[model samples]
Target: MADVRSMCAIGKHGQLGLNGKLPWEGTRAREFREDVQRFFEMTKGHVLLCGPRTRRSIPQFAYADRTIFEIRSSMPPAETIAMFPNRVIYIGGGPPVWSAYASFIRHWDITRLPYDGEADRFFDPAWLCGVRNGN
Candidate 1:
């Protein structure tokens, strides 16, 4: 079985997005680049799964050397895993995609931002607690 992992940056209130973008806009460009570079390095030579909208939201240069597996709502986690049985798989996107594959995830790398901002999308507090408790 492939090792499944995920990562996301959330706010104090579990906010993940606002108006289709991150709620905060004050992050330095270099910081963003370093974060992206780290993610790419972590999942290098493997598959990264994300929804079409999330995929489109990312800058093209960010994925120049990585293989992205565009996820559809109807695609089963088993099917996606089967496609990359010998590789590490990283899933990073919005709530729907996360919920769909949550059961298959073996590890999560969640970053809590220092401040809360207005958001229409959020990570579930219950889920985060459960994961932290190793439920």
Candidate 2:
């Protein structure tokens, strides 16, 4: 397997979204994009694997030589990672997608937003628990 990585923009309460949009400002977005871009640049231009929602959520600045794939079934990730082991995956969406790929992800550049108290979406508890327990 290649160096599989994961990225996300999370809030203080482990929230992922609010009203179908990000919970951060442009500066935070730029910072996340810069980190991702730098990571890919150093890794020989690895593709950013993401779902359709995530692909659309991305701004123009975050665009790179990416290969966007939708999460239709459970077989694709293994296949994708097999083809591009040096993967820089970005998990941005509802809880399901985040939980599915959180384990394989090696790195995360999470953005800490102020307490919005309005985030309706969250990452899967199982994943978080696993990480907390060092599974």
Candidate 3:
């Protein structure tokens, strides 16, 4: 079986999003771009699993060198994971999708942004600690 991983940027307070977009307007757009490029480089030639909303949020050009599995709310994570054995699958998205696949994920790549902002969505700190503790 492949190793399932999750990646995302979060605020100090665990905020992931605000009003359907990233909460922070990065002072340096290039740095943000570099971060995104690095993410692609790290996950290069691997499959990425994301929900519809996250998929739509991404620009069309961003999919150039990667394969993406669009996971619907109704899909079973185990079934999806089973479909990609011996591969590295990166899960990128919001809380619900994270919760759905939390049990199967073996690693997490969370980027902690420098500042905090108002947010409507958050990544649970407890979940991060649990994953780190191998719960």
Candidate 4:
């Protein structure tokens, strides 16, 4: 079986996003660019699982060569993972996706940037508790 992983870049305040875009979008920070590069590098050739909102945010050809599955409310997270047993699956989204699939992620890569910004969305540390106990 392949591994399920999560890669996220947050701000000093645990800010993940604001207004559907990255909180540090206009900050001209090297960390954000590096993080984005790392994400693309790591997720290359891997399956991506994201919710509808995340799917819509991505450009039409952004991940055209790779498999990007739109997670549906009717499908159980476990069942979705099972569909791609031989390939690494990366959970790509914000809090909602993380909260729903926390127990299935085998590894979590979180990068904290030096940005102090306003963000309506944040990454909750408590989400990892399910990963610790469930698997």
lDDT (Cα atoms) of all candidates against the true structure:
0.73, 0.55, 0.75, 0.80
lDDT of 1 by residue, 15-88 (tens): 88777777764566565546555766776776789988778777776577667878997887788778887778
Candidate 1 CA-lDDT value: 0.73
lDDT of 4 at 48: 89
Segments in model 2 whose C-alpha atoms lie over 4 Å from true places: 25-44, 86-94, 128-135
Query: Which candidate wins on TM-score?
Result: 4
Query: Candidate 4 residues 1-135, lDDT tens each?
Result: 459998888889898888888788766667778887777788878898988877776666658566888997678888889999889998987677788888788888999999886998888887767432221
Cα-based RMSD of candidate 3: 3.5
* lDDT of predicted model 3: 0.75
Point out where model 3 deviates above 4 Å: 25-31, 129-135
The predictions' CA RMSDs to the true structure, in order, are 3.9, 4.9, 3.5, 3.0
Model 1, runs deviating above 4 Å: 29-37, 125-135
lDDT of 2 at 14: 75
Q: Candidate 3 lDDT, tens digit per residue, 66-133?
A: 77879987788889888988888988776777777776777888887765568888887655543322
Clashing pairs in 1: none
Q: For model 3, what is the error of residue 102's alpha carbon versus the real structure, in angstroms, after optimal superposition?
A: 0.6
Ten residues in sequence with the least summed lDDT for candidate 3: 126-135
List the lowest-lDDT window of 10 residues for candidate 1: 126-135
